[model samples]
Target: MRSQQFLIFLLILKVNLKDVLLGFGNLKPGLKYSVLIFAVALPVMAYGSTLSDFSQYYPIWKPASDSTWNFILYESAIAIRMLATEFFYRGFLMWTLMEKMDERYANLIHSFVYMLMHIGKPPLEVPYSFIGGYVFAWVDLRSKSILPSFLIHFLGSLVFDLMIINQVFICL
Candidate 1:
């Protein structure tokens, strides 16, 4: 599953793997921007977690239950999935679109598609996904790589899972 999009991007699109994944030029700015955006997002995510019962929807941590090893495995898998997702959205889609059109339109297209993917998730999340998607695309464009957005997505998801766990197991 992870290799499919990458293969398409490489073979079909003829995009260089490094250009899409590692990007060209300096990456420090993207890294810093990712950190700053996440810092701001933490509080918003925290509050959003309170607005909905995420456990009913995701239940991602439920399968692991009480096993520490299982939890680690789940998180690892999620991180890998996020990597693939970023590659597809930020790397494949955006880069391909940018080749034919303006960067803004390409990014907006990417953001819309990105948001659509979150439709079945939490209600609040569906709407904000557009905003988050746009920001992530912007960060990827600025950094010229998907690494920064990948980190943000993976870490934010991990934190949200923890918050849901707290609400499900600890608070209740």
Candidate 2:
């Protein structure tokens, strides 16, 4: 089963190898990239704490009652979901909207769309998602790359998942 999965993954990877390589080639190196990454991540980390506090209002929002292995799998799945989300929202939607409108307007639209995407999530989460989307859109606009937003989104999700885990364990 593992081998089959690995083979399928490798096959998919091969198809996107050129785009992946080219994307990396286009990334700016050195201090500027590092600073942008920090700028993106630090706000998420700060705001994530507030989200964690807000999660307290929803006692049912904890992670599933699963084994360690299951939790790891869940975390991995969340990470993958976050990556796909960034690709869809920040990469595709933001890029397309920016092409059609001015930068400020596009970013506003992106943030609003991003907030709408979270309609099914807990109410407390919507505001943070809006703030995050705006920050990420701004970062993409200023940095001229999606990499920083991607990192920020991934790390933010990881932190949120961890918070869920902690809440679950505390309730136990």
Top-lDDT candidate index: 1
- For model 2, residues 85-108, the per-residue Cα lDDT tens digits are 665566656766876899788778
TM-score result, candidate 2: 0.63
What lDDT is obtained when candidate 1 is compared to the true structure? 0.80
Model 2's C-alpha root-mean-square deviation from the true structure amounts to: 6.8
The lDDT per prediction is: 0.80, 0.60
> Looking at candidate 1, what is the lDDT of residue 3?
59
lDDT of 1 by residue, 51-145 (tens): 65565665465675465566678889899888888888888788788889998999899899999998878788877889888998898888778
